[model samples]
Target chain A: DAGVTQSPTHLIKTRGQQVTLRCSPKSGHDTVSWYQQALGQGPQFIFQYYEEEERQRGNFPDRFSGHQFPNYSSELNVNALLLGDSALYLCASSSGGRREGHLNTEAFFGQGTRLTVV
Target chain B: QKEVEQDPGPLSVPEGAIVSLNCTYSNSAFQYFMWYRQYSRKGPELLMYTYSSGNKEDGRFTAQVDKSSKYISLFIRDSQPSDSATYLCAKKRNDYKLSFGAGTTVTVRA
Candidate 1:
């Protein structure tokens, strides 16, 4: 079975510009969540998508948004990117949504897209 | 204070030695604890997970959780060069989101 997959392994964007990162969840998984890992830091949750709608979100501002398609693929869009936006964008997929019980809800991650804002 | 706090250690150890990593959390609502290992320029891979206040062993990895003390630990036995990676301690509550600590970078020298 194929694991989680992300597109454009590396990307460079300019300040005030916009960028979109893509993710395809693992087979048999229904939920997709996005995370940002800054240099020398662990990943911070961005948001989670389920049933083609955003179900949970973290501390990120409105500039960061995402969409989940019927096929379970997801796209993360960052508008008016800032220099601090440079980080590793990771996509993780799990079996069920937040409404489901937490037990055995292991999330598998993709290699992540490296986003650099110049 | 951060929800989860871990030492960012560039800890170096000889091969076949035991590698210990620890993290502390301030939230008692965090019932699920996990350890993830990430290589350079790669996403984190889950290594071990535990829910209760005790120990769970899997192969060379043993994860220990102390709910009373709000502490969690991961131990790698007979570590190899391939075991060198950044170790992340993560905690989760009823929500699906995870709160992670600053990862600890470990190097196992051959």
Candidate 2:
């Protein structure tokens, strides 16, 4: 089965422009999570979508938002993108039951979209 | 202050060497610990996960969680170049939130 898949493997955009990144969760996965990994940094949680609703979010600003469709495909939208917004946008999918602390599942990730805000 | 702290090391080691990566968190409430491996320009893949305190071993990867010390570690045995990547330690801060460290870059020379 295909693992998490992302779109626009690489892209360059001018400052003030907007960008949309897409992702399809791995097979049998029902939850989708988005993360941003800057150079020399680990992936930072953006938010997680379950049952087509945003179940949780991180310390990101309003400019960063996302949506998950009925089919478990997700899209991340960033408006008025700044240079600092340029990073490798990763999409991760988790499968399994939920627990108190964690969702209690293993996560698979997409290769990620390399966004370069020029 | 960052919730999780990890040394971003470009740690180099010879083949078959044992490698250890660690992270510390300020949030004492964090109960779930995880380690993720990411290659160049690629997304991170789950390497290890453990709940509460103790050690969990899977093959050459061993994940240890010390809740009392607020520290966690990932050990790789018989390392290979394929294991060369950034190892990120993460913890669940709340019910559905995860906080990740800066990641440690490890290069295993084959």
Candidate 3:
């Protein structure tokens, strides 16, 4: 079975522009999550989508929004991108949402898209 | 202070050496601990996950958690050049919120 897949291995956008990154979950998985990793830093949680609804969110601003499709695929949209938004946008997937005894709930991540905002 | 603190090491070690990575968190509510490995320019892949204070081993990798001290560690045995990557330590608290530390980069040279 294929693991999580992300589109456009690399992307470049100018300041104030908008960019959309996509991700397809692993086979049999239904939850999708997004993260952002800055240079020399760990991936920071952006938000998580389950049942096509956002169940959790991080401290990101309103400019960062996302949608989860019925197929469990996801898209992260960032509007009015700033230089600070230049980072690797990572997409991860897990089977089911948070609950007891979740088998590792290990999120399989894709080879993130490197977003460069100039 | 950051909720989670980790040494951002560009640590270089010869092949066959054992590697130890660690992170500390200030929150006591953290119940789940995890470690992720990320190659250059790649997203992180989950390496190990453990709940509460204890030890969990998988092959050459071992994850240790000391909830009493709010510290966690990831140990790599028989480190190889292919093991070279940045290791991140993360904690999941309420609502499955994940807080990550600045990862430590390891370079295993043959």
Candidate 4:
């Protein structure tokens, strides 16, 4: 089966420009989450999408938002990017939603998109 | 203090050496512990996971958790150069979201 797949393996944009990163969850999975990882750091939770709505979000600002389609695919959008936004954007997928608490859900990740803001 | 703490070690070791990575968390509510390994310019891949206090072994990897001290450990046996990567310790607080450590980088020299 195909694992989580992310498009535009790499991207470049100006400070005032906006960018969108896309993700397709693994087969049989229903939830998708987004994360950002700066150099030499671990991935930080951005937000999670389920049922086409955002279920949980991290410490990110309003400038960062996402969407999930019925097919369990997801997109992350960052508006008015800053140089600090230059990092790796990662997408992870799990099988279910809220019930994930006690289920020992293991999230599968994509190769990630490298976004470079100039 | 951060929810989870880990050593960011660019630790270098000779081949076949045993490697030990550790992380400590301040929350007792964290019920699941996981270890992920990420190569350069790539996403992290789950390596091992454990729920309770004690040890879980899989192949050359062993995951140990100490709920009492809120500490977790991952041990690698017969380490190879290919084993070199960044290791992240993550904890789930009875919820789906994960809190990750700063990640420890390892390099196994041939």
TM-score of each: 0.98, 0.94, 0.95, 0.97
> What is the per-candidate TM-score for chain B?
0.97, 0.95, 0.95, 0.97
Cα lDDT tens digits, model 4, B21-90, are: 9999987874789999999888899998888999999999999999988889999999999999999999
lDDT tens readout by residue for model 1, B1-110 = 99999987889999999999999998787468999999999999998888899999999999999988898999999999999999999998888788999999999999
Per-residue C-alpha lDDT of model 4 across residues A27-94, encoded as one tens digit per residue: 98889999999988888999989899998899999999999998999999999999999999999999
Ranking by TM-score: 1, 4, 3, 2
Q: Which consecutive 10 residues in model 3 chain B have the weakest lDDT in total?
A: B90-99
Return the clash pairs for model 1, or none.
Answer: none
**Superposition error at B93 for model 3 (Å):** 1.9
DockQ score, prediction 3: 0.61
DockQ of each: 0.71, 0.67, 0.61, 0.70
Cα deviation of A115 in candidate 2 (Å)?
A: 0.2
What TM-score would candidate 3 get against the native?
0.95
**Cα lDDT listed for each candidate:** 0.93, 0.87, 0.88, 0.91
> lDDT of model 3 at residue B50?
84
**Tens digits of per-residue lDDT for model 2 on A44-117?**
88999988889888889999999999899999999998999989998889865255455447778899999999
Ten contiguous residues minimizing lDDT sum, candidate 1 chain A: A95-104
